[model samples]
Target: MSQPDTLGYLVPQFPGQTHIFFWREIAALEAMGVTPVLFSTRRPPAGLIAHDWSEAAMARTTYLGEVSLRRAARVLPRLPWGALLREAGRDGIAVLKDVLVCAAAGEALRDHCARQGISHVHVHSCGRAALIAAFARHLGGPGYSLTLHGPLSDYGPGQRYKWRHARFATVITRKLIAEMQAELPKDLPPMILRPMGVDTDYLRRDTPYRPVQPGEALRVFACGRLNVVKGHQDLIEAVRQLRAAGHDVTLEIAGQDDDGGGGFRLVLEQLIKQHRLQDHVRLLGAIDAASVKARLLEAHVFALASWHEPLGVAYMEAIACGVPTIGTAAGGVPELIDDGVEGLLVPPKAPEALAAALLRIAEDPALAQRLSTTGRARIERDYSARLGAEVIVSEMRKALG
Candidate 1:
């Protein structure tokens, strides 16, 4: 009498919230009565490795190794060398590295899949995660699926064999789907627009957000890895301008400080001091999910001035919690926030624009309240995790049956 084996490929180690996604997805599928054996990688910690999810998701999960050398070789030749690097002298070498890497890792992943008799493999990102799934599926004949997000790759339409290994692909926004399709055939595998849904039970809109206490500096919260695409610099400059113009703003950043323990992090610290923002800016490195929920409750506004995003569940979660939002006009963000409705959208990399939007929200109580009320409604209606689960489950049934 042993625990039943019902799992598929899963990478519990991917960075940020994405690392937690497959586990959550498994839970959703289990709630629908389909158990999958987890093929786990190094992404998740040991304690989280063999988990019995809150909704009994483990009934459908069986952890698996994250490496396979042989399977990787099959997907290596398909790397869609970006049009920009099509002819680079080092491009071939780069492709060779990718081939070796995937062949090696994919071979291991495939072995685990075979041992479990798993019928399908689904990956959370189009980067190496999807590539590994693609390679494993190619070697073992599992119907495979991959989800795309920003930074997966700057792929052009039909550029290489990006999704060639997948039976179907899922992306979070129409905008991203369109960009990905640029490199795909006129008709790509049932590209589905599925927003990353939050655990509806954990995140809610019933929290109360109130007026800042007199002279209590406004707390502006931004989350995500401190990288160029996140536009952290733009936010810092905007906050500086706001303070210079006599606005009282307190900014708190939460994410990993990959700054040599100081890289972009040091630059951010230097900028804060240069702007004399020692009193206004604070850095909280990589807060957990519970802490993030608390911050969302206390936050005056959520700002993600990123230049690239596939679809930010962070923003959706904020609105779901009844907080208004402001983000840069880039990637799939527009597809999420209906400008002047759910949230305000500004030009990417424009500090002045961001500052103006922030100050406007700070000053307009009615507008903020209005957005908070209606924005949550939008999430409940259009972006619920229930919707994602249903769409993905339907697709999985079609593929598996």
Candidate 2:
């Protein structure tokens, strides 16, 4: 069959590990004869884009933020003056800066896509990039759509505005869809349920699951940005308490501090010292994908006590590697992990509950084995990247018709 028409992707950053799901989805779509052209708002740091898999992608991505606006007069006639003024009135002075900047960049992006014959645009988040797509569409550009993910607090002034104008919107989980419906009851846009996916083949572990023995130390691994929302502090406290209770457990956390400065790292260090858990908890800084897989292979249990998350991919990765996963009953996580079937679910910020779940896995070998087997099977059956890309393509086809 001939290749499908190319689709433009408006994203905050291109080729960053944080958005690995997008990369996997694009790869799957390419295999099915769909081309994805990336348009990023900002170029990420060199260190973040250093992965071998992202080298070619970085070269192809266009960073609109870095483009100088010398031809502003040339694209002035394409501006949607009525839509711009109405949006300005709705948000007051608060959105004026974003509106002006993103609108200009949107025009440039629109012209670029027009030259490349791209007729449809998809934005990954409801941030400035989504606003840019909406602005472009209002200026007689291509029809656009949005793929929504969230912490629920990041939806600002133009969120509802973008949703209302897009061709259709997609959310990664049902929980997020419900939240969006409740927020925008009046002009709620059409929504589709499309969950992110993982590559089961790349994440599959060859070594079989080994249960913890009486005298061996139980290895626990967790990975994500070490920010307050991730609830790494709560995980540390749980491990400290577990060690105090005479359980042979060691927790290894792999992530970089993301609190602007080094303040968050200091707080975690203080907690470790106060509990005298110097030997029990190891702070392994941010690691690559290979390192993450290696750590998961050695771990008996994987846990991330996030107080708020929009369907964490780390949990899915661990589960695919045959490790018994533990996650809080936060946003969209319960959808990926059934309470006791795929993995254990605990309440956020509750060290006692987290400790209880860890102990349950440590004490029951059969339970751990069952979770591992079922979790991997779930990924193979429903969470492949191709499945998600196929659903998105189906929606795109309908929108075109």
Candidate 3:
């Protein structure tokens, strides 16, 4: 296990905000003299490669849609057809479709890795990409590993098979490790905790922890997709409650509509109007990384009442920038921020609890400042992009061995 020379990095999207953690990890790996080849299942939206870092990544990245069938055919003859067919058949039509696409992608990836001399593949999600990575490994290309970001419910039955086949796997929280261990077979690969994080330096604010002045409206900031799991609707309802209670509060939500075909955004918009929070809540759709940091700096409180967040990097960014953050005690959030230590944790999908938490922070500046100071220190002490990268690279070495 003398260090792996070349590794393949597989992701669903290449340069989107959701993949920012992967960008940081790739940068860290490059700093340590490892070669990484980026592979995306599809091309990102127009102009996503806006920043210098993303632009640079676009050069080394390969969009799997551009994969040629002629090249993929090289590995098809070597594939274990019986096992592959059985695996595909066990799943329904939906999974069979994924398997067909994944098998083709695997064949293409195998051919690409052979030419590049890549010995390992690391997929970012436990979804289709991981399935493709497992398929590629089964095609006798290279060792593979996976990182689980979303809830396990999102993954299909094939996920268990992928976990068993991966060389090693890492979940963003220890709770996920326990869940997977209990559900998966004993022969599954080693599962470890490697939490998602932010580059604190990138999110550094010139004036961290800005106290709200008298008569100034409190800037309540929340960032994430305008979808259900993020609980944006719940946050909006809480803000509505806060406004009703005679608190001068305005919430700025910064994220795109991740739901297909603008459905969820419409729902959120209707909720805002129904609650008459049109003036109180501003939907700033899809702000960049710089804008996110800027909003965090100008805010008195950062909150995301997500129902099931695996490990929110937005909370890390806000906490790193000294914003008194609040998150739901759902899915690895408590692992990142304590109830009263680093930040406040409220029950998920409870608009009343969310409003209470926001009200508490707004009324008590001392509590807000205390949480801000402690949260910043926690980010500095426990979370960093470099630290996460080092852990992942070390695990890759173990897998290589």
> What lDDT does model 1 reach?
0.67
Winner by lDDT: 2
- Better model by TM-score, 1 or 3? 3
What are the Cα lDDT values of the candidates? 0.67, 0.81, 0.80
Q: Give the RMSD in angstroms, all C-alphas superposed, for model 1.
A: 5.2
Q: For residues 145-197, what per-residue lDDT tens digits would candidate 3 score against the true structure?
A: 88888677687656656777888877888888888777665647887788887
In candidate 2, what are the lDDT values of residues 261-319, reduced to their tens digit? 26576777888888888888877765667888899999999999999888988998899
Clash list (residue pairs), candidate 3: none
* Pairs with steric clashes in candidate 2: none
Ranking by TM-score: 3, 2, 1
What is the C-alpha lDDT profile of model 1 across 1-401, one tens digit per residue? 01122436455343233334455565677787766565544443332222224224334333433444454555566444453144234335554444455554565666666666666767665555555565566556466776666643553122244366566777787777766667455536777878777665667746466745557677788877767788888988999999999888988887654432366777788888888888888867666666777888898898989888767877887888888889877888888898989999999989999999998888887888888888888888887676666676677667765
Arranged by lDDT with the best first, the candidates are: 2, 3, 1
Q: After superposing candidate 3, which stretches have Cα over 4 Å from the reference? A: 1-3, 47-53, 68-78, 85-93, 259-261
Question: Which stretch of 10 consecutive residues in model 2 shows the poorest summed lDDT?
Answer: 44-53
